[model samples]
Target: MDPLERLSSPAPEFLDRLAASTRALHWLVALPVLLLLLTGLTNFWPELKALHVGGARVFAWLHVLIGLGFAVALVPSVIAILMRRAARRDARELLAFGLDDYLWLQHRVLRAAGLRSVGPRVGKFNAGQKLNAVLSAAATAALMGTGVVLGVNYWSKDVFDVDLVGAVFRWHTVLSVLLLPLIAGHLYMALLNPGTRESLRGVTTGRVRRSWAERHHGAWADRVREERRAGEG
Candidate 1:
């Protein structure tokens, strides 16, 4: 089937699924990351820094506030998943990776470039998306840790020597720069790519069109079918 045809709603036999907690957490996490990027850019570029008086100082404090929000934002999703049985199951489905995911990555890249669909059956989270999630989580943790350290130095002089804090700041800055490409690619896939646009609804509404799920995540579609059949039986 043409991928575009599947953009519309699919039959009930096709599953529409994503945890409500997952949907909420995505937006929660996105806010601070975007704020950090915006403020960091102003501080990073001298010309931009010079454009507004006290902008750097103002954003520095704002970054700290958002940084704290970033840290807090991660906790509720994890807690909700662990506490809710359905969410726990969904988390497992998202985290599990096997042979199909590896093959999907190999072909999906080519398919995205206009080649034929020669990929293996993919799950709800494709290999690329899974990798993106893992990397993004790790980067967020690192940013939070480094940001805290930097914030400490800014407010108090006695916690650690200036040199140690400077080194940590450098690492934080480097990680922030490295994250740009991943963020850019994520935006392209989530917003710009026509084929994947429907997937965005999963985050916004806790479900995507069943057709898009099946077309992009065939293996996951199969699993959902099995679960539904088992439940009925």
Candidate 2:
């Protein structure tokens, strides 16, 4: 039997724990962004002028602190990703894809728009998830770049022109706005999608239905069964 096959078959408990951890991390990251956005709006919206400058300063400081917290969370997130990569490499299923996965993507999109007759069978992550991952990485990089520029502008206005800083700020705001919709979609999919909802349960309880594993990750499920059989043999 292939070593990859052995590794791909995650125990139900293991998959559950991993999903829960990932979701918790997501919420951890989102809370700070929400707070930062609220504080940011006070600075940007004149209608919010009732807010005192002192309060604004406090919010600004809080935003920076929260941003720092967000960065810190990346440490654990990076470690998890590395672990996942190792697991996938050993299992030969990192970003695993097949005809069913692609068909699932098409079906999901059609179903979303009320056009598909039947839903497609998805794998661990759907096409939308892959797209979200790419977008998130890009957004995080942009946010970091813009944040540095804005932070430095306070001391070296000449070196980092006020106009340039302003432009970066706009980009930062736009990116943040764009993320809002994506995040909402992600949440809905996780919480509302029947197939995905069970997978999400692993986040909180660290366990999923055996049936779910078989339906969504058939290949992975088979690998696990094979491993178990080999071990028994």
Best by TM-score: 1
Off by over 4 Å in 1: 1-14, 47-56, 109-117
Candidate 2: residue 141 Cα off by (Å) = 2.5
Candidate models: Cα lDDT each:
0.76, 0.62
Writing each residue's lDDT as its tens digit, candidate 1 over 98-157 gives: 888788887867887988877777766888888787788788789888988887777788
TM-score for each of the candidates = 0.84, 0.67
Error of 1 at 225 (Å): 2.7
Give the Å error, residue 216, model 1: 0.6
Per-residue lDDT of 73 in model 1: 63
Give the per-residue Cα lDDT of candidate 2 at 32: 68
